[model samples]
Target: MHRQFADLRARFLARKYRTERGHEFACYGFSRRLGTMVRAIDVVFEKLPPELDTIPDRDTVVDATLMIQAFVLNAFGCLDNLAWIWVCEKPVLNARGKELGPLEVGLGPKRRDVRASFSKEFVAYLEKRQDWVDKHLKGFRDSLAHRIPLYIPPYIVSPRLSKSTTSSKKPVEMPSESLTWGSTTSCRPSSADWASGGLG
Candidate 1:
């Protein structure tokens, strides 16, 4: 990975991007939230079965589904943090014309100052993108958070199944099979590995 952040920070934008009392280094928040989303995605990928016919392990599948939800939440968090960067940079205002207080902060319609600070094209682009994110990421995360969690069926109906069987409410039963060691175990990194601050 590019590890030149310190070098870059020392060279450029350090003085220019200094935060005011209410402002912050929102880019750091964006990066941290993005990192969280990436880790969630990595775990979700790990839980994914190598084949459609792989053993349907309930625990692993459930963990993977939850991680997927986590990824969506964190992904939206990335956008929220990014929105703060623009708001802080332009120093937006409220109706009273006071520097906008930290209130609802996200890539949503509420952050009107953030939208107004940008060019028309950029604002339009953000609106469309926010719509997409709201539909895809926010809806899923909201459902998982407030309504219902994702449900991974106990069985994965193989795509190789006959059309008739796949069309039916019940998939044709398959024989049970042994799985690899990784399949039977949790996908989480060990505490020691996490303590090392490395991708063990």
Candidate 2:
């Protein structure tokens, strides 16, 4: 997957599409990548066993959590880039009649423009979940980008024993163990949510 994405990115860069369309293409590419990552995370999570004894090893849990964090960070970055492109990629004239680039528009104006230009449904969704974006996604992204030590709490699993006439064996009783990722707990959305065109 890494190599495939690298090749795709290389091909994209080689074309050197620097126009407004290019920005849109870039946004599309990033969105696809984000979707892929989300799917991969979902697959990993699904592979986790429901039985405590049948749970995957610690390494697997760590890797899965890391992938989740990666997805969250990438989603935030991709969306931000897309918003910037939508808001500021257009050519603007300055006082001296010079064409201002995207970066020249400044962050504040770019954000306002993005909000104003976005679809009504998208704008409403953002308005409703602004706190989640700021607190969970943005906070996690910042912590990751700055290399801050994050506290990853363990995933507690309590597997319920099934009742079947074929098997009379009692379910093994085991205490829940904390699967540490680091300083932070797992912050993953439901896989079904992604499949239904939610955050992914």
Candidate 3:
């Protein structure tokens, strides 16, 4: 949050912070969840190996996986809680015919209510974020929560690569590797693009 916003938030509390208005307190709730996400990630970093190829002990693996799940859930929670901030800023959004919940705020044909409820600029911002979430976060989070739990494979090896590479005693890596570079908007994303913080 910006310093100006922090100052304004204090002013809002001094003036309009009422027990009945749920949104007034939502900013704090959002803050706490964001903090949890950060803490969970830090805990994961401490508990798990930094290198992908280095496996943790079985007990540590279980603990770290739980922390990762916490991190992911809290990230989405922070997003959802922003809707409450909107409700506080624009009370009409929660008025009779336009009640918008946190989960209800999104951009899509099916989410026309969300587009209609927020400003055009806000919807445009949401479009980009939703795309990123769909591509990166949703599948992993959903799978961990609802389907198969997150799996940290010991290693990756395709059948064809295994046959040729395993013949020698040396380790076999790069089962499937392709290197490419172009404008991010035109190219498929790769680790090389994100690790140094470009594509994202």
In terms of lDDT, the best-performing candidate is 1
Model 3 alpha-carbon miss at residue 36, Å: 1.1
Candidate ranking (TM-score, best to worst): 1, 3, 2
True-structure lDDT of candidate 2:
0.52
Please write out the lDDT profile of model 1 over residues 95-174, one tens digit for every residue: 67776555644456566665667788887877667656655666555555555665555553334454656578975665
lDDT values, one for every candidate:
0.56, 0.52, 0.53
Candidate 2 per-residue lDDT, tens place, 1-200, comes to: 66666676566456544476545646465646655675766655665434434446667767666676677667766655554444434433455666445444322222444355456887787778766765576556655655452333454332242233125666655443423122335344333322211122
- Residues 1-200 of candidate 3 have per-residue lDDT tens digits of 34544565455445553344544446466656656666677777787646534434667767776787787666655555554554545543533576666445533324445456677787778776766775566545555555566543333455566577768888755523311111111122443333211012
- Cα lDDT, model 1, residue 53: 49
* Number of the candidate with higher TM-score, 1 or 2: 1
Indicate the residue-level lDDT of 163 in model 2: 31
> Which pairs, if any, clash in model 1?
none
- Give the TM-score of each candidate: 0.64, 0.50, 0.59
Question: Number of the top candidate by TM-score?
Answer: 1
lDDT of candidate model 1 versus the reference: 0.56
